[model samples]
Target chain A: MSKKVKIVAATGCPTGIAHTFMAEEALKRAAEKLGVEIKVETHGQVGVQNQLTKEEIRAADGVIVAADKDVDAGRFKGKPTVDVSVSAGIKEAEHLIQQIIDGKARPYKGNSNAESKQEESSEGKSAGGFGRAIYKHLMNGVSHMLPFVVGGGVLIALSFLFGIHSANPDHESYNEFAAFLNSTGGVAFGLMVPILAAFIGQSIAQRPGMVAGFVGGMMANTGGAGFLGGIVAGFIAGYIILLLMKLLKGLPRTLDGLKAIFLYPLFGIFLTGAAMYFVVEPMTTINEAMMSFLSNFQDANPILLGLIVGSMSALDMGGPVNKAAYLTGTALLSDGNFFFMAGVSAACITPPLITAFATVFFRKFFNEQERNAGLVNFILGSTHITEGAIPFAAKNPIVVIPILMVGSSISAILTYIFSVQVPAPHGGFLVLPVVTNGVLWVVAILIGSLVGGFIYGMYQKYSYQKTK
Target chain B: MELLNKNLIKMHTNFQTQEEVFEGIASLAVEQGLASDKKTVVAGLANREKESTTGFFDGFAIPHTKNSAIQKAGIVIMVNESGLEWNSMDGQPAKFFISLLIPENEAGTTHLTLLAAVSRMLVHEDIRAKLLTLENEEKIYEEIKRFLSENM
Candidate 1:
């Protein structure tokens, strides 16, 4: 009789939040379904649980390290191991287990006296594989930056509720409380880009990456390349530090401390700074041209303009394209084009609200957990949190994203037609009183949401029937 | 001194659970005059188990404790034809239960070295496979001693 395959796994995330536990449960369920004997250890905020004993490690056929942050993989040395992000652990646990079963996984040679030589030589060959690794590093940045964005963006909107000029000391209606809120929000916003770059770098080269990444982000800010510039700088900084480590690898063991403290930071900053100045200059120019194009776009046919902007906003759902549209709206707000922001805001809420609506209408299309998530999306959407729709879109991107984009386009066009204007950069329904043609703004959002939800629900129903 | 002597090894035992296997081993430790009391030794093993399960994959468990109830550091090795149900990480029953009892002050010194040695010994597939097939306690002890002396 063939022996039963046995595997051990560890799951962890930076926040030690839902994803860590979710991945653990998902792996367990998948293993059970696949008839594979598996053990999972979770490195959570509470610390490690269900730790793999030394005996278990020795007996296991393979290991899976599903984590966002660094994990001690030393124990799995000489074992076939698959190291991946926690999200992959949640979504592709079966695939990972199958890889181990098929003997496709590489043997993990951790940093031990005998193995470190092989590890270093292999590391020299590949800095890291592309695709998944790149996404993991980028997410490390985005996850850290999100809290600042939400806190700052909402506070800035709240200050506007007191009046657009209430935070200005020279204004007739200047309020100390409004000023405090505005300053605090501004401080958070100021740190957002730097934090994003720092974490991305940290994911790559640890502490040394953070120093270089922070500098790169500051360069982006001063250089006016915005968030895109920050992303480029982060990648450049991380890769440069990685290269430095590789180059200085032959250094004596006693000088290892000097490499991290002096050589890495010094060389990393110098290279990243040069790249940002020389290479990133064109990016800032393009960004400026895009802003100008957006400003000039007001004279174009309103319906066509609304369609393009709305589609762009919904295309990636908080990704680069979405950020571009949102940034354009914020820039135009400064230039006093309030209606541009109104269209942007209307489009932003459409995806999540439509997702919620679809979930409620076509009950059979969603599972219990998803239905609950859909319910939560309603509150998130109403508050202008477009990220609420991300889970739904991520699951069925091909069908869901296109439908969401169409609905968002329709919403934007309607908002433009109704001449709705929003002075604030954020706050969905909460800042409704400050919106000119507020009632029409609400009407445009509802109409777009209903249209999008109906189309998505019909598609789901048809697919479900076909599958049945 | 040889750790897994004939006196400490039990072959083809019928214990059917982790607790039961541990109880049988603790009593053996007392019978061999290596432990002060059977009850205290069993309680120590149970307490250690509560802290973390020592059950490993491929039907092996090493439940251990460092307590004042032990007169000397010793290992009790039990081999069962039928595996005992254990709340192991891999969810597999354990057929080989190696219980260790050490005097409190000597916890981290000799006891830890022996534990490490045992761990290192078990990591080899050939050694484990050979050990599993040996039905005689004297042969099992000889096999373990030869492997450890050669490797360690």
Candidate 2:
């Protein structure tokens, strides 16, 4: 048939220590043994070596991605690919090459339209771990969804600068320009969840997934299901389309075009729509209930709520625990609970300030290096960079973390007690102008930091004495 | 290439276990000024091992690490007198140890060429046998260096 088959292989391992290069060598040797031309791309710790060009991939008969990590399989969309672990490339290199020669390579159904359906029925042709594949698809969707969120969020935030209700024509503060910007931002923001779902679908089943995902996302949005609903809709839509793709694999080649454009979309959307319809309503209710429940707790007792928020925010100092607190506050903020976010920000701002204060008060107890570092913390604490406190907390977490949390809690409690409302999700004191009772909020944070700093300095002095 | 030399190769080395081998490598690399400290190099190798075994079947293991602690790129070969547990593909202990240490900042071409060449040589059974059975440190050094120079 062909003069000499050309194969392109990518090899990678978790550490890029030894197996990656070994696999590359094995693949090259095997290709030579089989009398075929081959090019090996190695994803090593040193980074990608002997990278395969687009022209090479297009010209090659098959692709072998022997990777324990993501090598951007999206590039080899329509090419026949044998995706396997790196170990296989080393141990069964010749077999993999031979499979491609024997026309056993199944084309990757990337963004490429339906082509090379002859071996579509082949079992496990594009072998990969299931959870990783889905995770990759989800990340693809989220990345595409980000620009819309940022652009829309900034515009919306800017629109509110005129007045809170300036976008409403009937409101006293209504401005036509404000309305225009707000609506435009709303348009972009509205597309965020839908785009997230659509791209996720597209990632899984190609174009057909896009169609089903968009339709499902629209249903989720209309049903008031919000972010969680969009996620559910996207996954369901993608998988249903995938199942449909498998079912329709045995159809005649003549019907390939018909199946992609007509059959797949029609069934994919209908099924996704039916499934998402039942899911969206429940998700919306759950979302509302969750928000209201948290808000109710906010109303019941400010002290307990403040302590929880403060402790959680200061616990990890920008690690996952801190992020969880921030994200939860952001979620509430999205639902118009500015009070909760105000307390969250106050707590976040307090920890760094505590460290800054500790260095100042306990100067003799601390070394020269720590005192200089403490001065830098003043700038860090002012802008609400909680990570600035990490070095201090990391020094003796057992003694420092609890003290910082106490200070952070006191600040959050004061902000809550004063009924401070911070409109922006983040930006620390930078968003103060828009904040109701902004000065009071700053007072709450300083009081917390002052108390925290006092305790920290005392502890440092005590530890110094004990060590001596 | 200064990647491998006679001085880098050691024949009939005495190492009972992986830790002992690492201890040997750490001291050698520090003495040669290829690394900042023994702990960093030893930790780097241990960390790499924790992620995945560097062992290839048929009595070969190539442990490698690229980090800021490394002062330069270099290779060290130790033909162990006794086999050590490596969890190799063929379920056999690895005796021939080829460790590659790379600086964090290098463009990667130097080590990549060396690694590729070493792996290419190891891939062929006959060549592997020849490498394993090489008489002394000088012969092993010359053979490995020749392979690297020719391929690189």
Candidate 3:
């Protein structure tokens, strides 16, 4: 009889929540069902548990990296590695495992091997598998962005609760409160873009790549690139760092050690910033025209605008795409235009409100735990929290999507009718104190959300009745 | 015990309180032989509520009971126009409610089927919008049926 082959695996996602564990379980189950013995490692938010040691890696026939975020591929320098997203790990784990067993997998040696002999390169690692790694790092940055979103939003809600809706850019009391809020909340918000860039960079170039990415992100934001620019800057930083790391591969031990940490970051940041500022800026500016076009769209197409904004709000929940729409609308805040932001803020809370209220009104439809979760979702929605919908949307997209669209559209219409305008490019209740018609904006949102929730509940009720 | 039946979706509902919502679904359960009495059904479902909330992810909630309050199995679907306020993990309001009353032993893969169907359809934005726009009981049923058939 032929000897059995053994392999080690790791599974993780950017969120490090359900998908991470789910993939791990799937892979384990698949291996067991296939009559194979496998060792799996998981790096999650609670930290790495059930980790595979060097011995396990060395003994395994091959490694499977099923992750959405960056997993260190350096360790398995010469081992046959099959890299896939966490979703694939969960859905196609057996197939992936089998592929690895058949020796169809490729080896991935960090950037160190990129400059090695061409003859040995085919046996070396590939660099093109960094897309998934970059996505993972981006999610890390977003995970860290939540605190800022909540804190800033709540503070602004408090400002509104205090009835301090200031419109002037030069008021003392308003500025002081704004300063306090900025100090408390803005710092975290400010970190969003840089952190995004840093992690994206880190994914490609490892720990040493963070500084360059962060600096590049800062430059992008300062140069009007915002988060999107930060993303571009991050890739540039990462690739530059990786190239430099490759170039410095054959240096002496001491110099090489210092070069990876200090020299690479220094040069990488300067090069990335210079490149983005000079090369990327002009190219991206062309896209900014799209933003400008959206901003100045006054063709009396309220329905079109509503649909666009509604879709954009739900498309990414709170990612960069969502932020783009939000920022475009809020950018008018400085010019005393709050209508755009009011629409966005309204669109923001409607999904959660509808979900929460539907559970409360129709207890028969929800299981005990889901109804309870609805309450928390509603609270988050009221505060303009959007990520709260992620778990639900992730679990059931069809039901959530329609619910989101209906709720968002209703809110968007209400905001338009209320003429609520926001000046800032990105904020929820955090921008309330600085928004036009803050109280009216909130009222409009509440009313629209009520309508949306009611409609959704009715629809669910009808659908259930017919299903029986 | 199926708490949700085809008639869960009523053309016009007059629910003014939690009891009304419970009664609406409980009657269906009683008729389907899932529950012997409305009060007992309410109590049993309410008891389950003490254990945990029923807000499932993906914009639908399946409030159910396998406990003693139910004598028969039935399902009741409810859709609100302004939507009810429930705490969801996503911090959003729920628009659809799939109330299910299943017999302790009889509620096997059916529940999973329903959950999976809802999850699958919810993932599609266009189909979901069509569901929300659906007004007639037959149309809603067709949508659910299609979703289940395709997904299952």
TM per model?
A: 0.51, 0.46, 0.45
Candidate 2 per-residue lDDT, tens place, B1-152, comes to 57777777778888998878887787788878788888889888887876667787788988878768888788888889989978677767999988988887877565666665676677767767888888898888888777766666
Worst 10 residues of 3 chain A by lDDT: A113-122
Comparing 1 and 2 on lDDT, the stronger one: 2
* Candidate 3 lDDT by residue in tens digits, A282-311: 634544654665666633466667666766
Q: Candidate 2: what lDDT?
A: 0.78
Which model is ahead, 1 or 2, in terms of DockQ?
A: 2
- What is candidate 1's CA lDDT for residue B136? 91
lDDT of each: 0.75, 0.78, 0.63
> Which parts of model 3 have CA positions greater than 4 angstroms off?
A1-135, A165-179, A243-255, A278-410, A417-468, B1-152
lDDT, candidate 1, A1-468, per-residue tens: 298889999988654423466567668777887889999987755467788999998899899989876667877877998887776786588998988888877887453222232233345434443544565677778767756755675676577667667888998979999889888977877776777788878877777888899899888766655555577778888878877776776777678678768998899999989988974566546555655666677656879878977887787665546767789898889999898999999999898889889999997676545676678667667767686665566445567789999999999999999999999877687678889999999999999999999998999889766644
In candidate 1, clashing pairs total 0
* Per-model chain A TM: 0.60, 0.55, 0.53
Least lDDT summed over 10 consecutive residues: which range in candidate 1 chain B?
A: B107-116
True contacts kept of each: 0.00, 0.42, 0.00
Name the runs in model 2 displaced over 4 angstroms.
A14-17, A45-51, A111-468
* DockQ-derived CAPRI band for the predicted complex in model 1: incorrect
What lDDT is reached at residue A160 by model 1? 64
Q: Candidate 1's chain A scores what TM-score?
A: 0.60
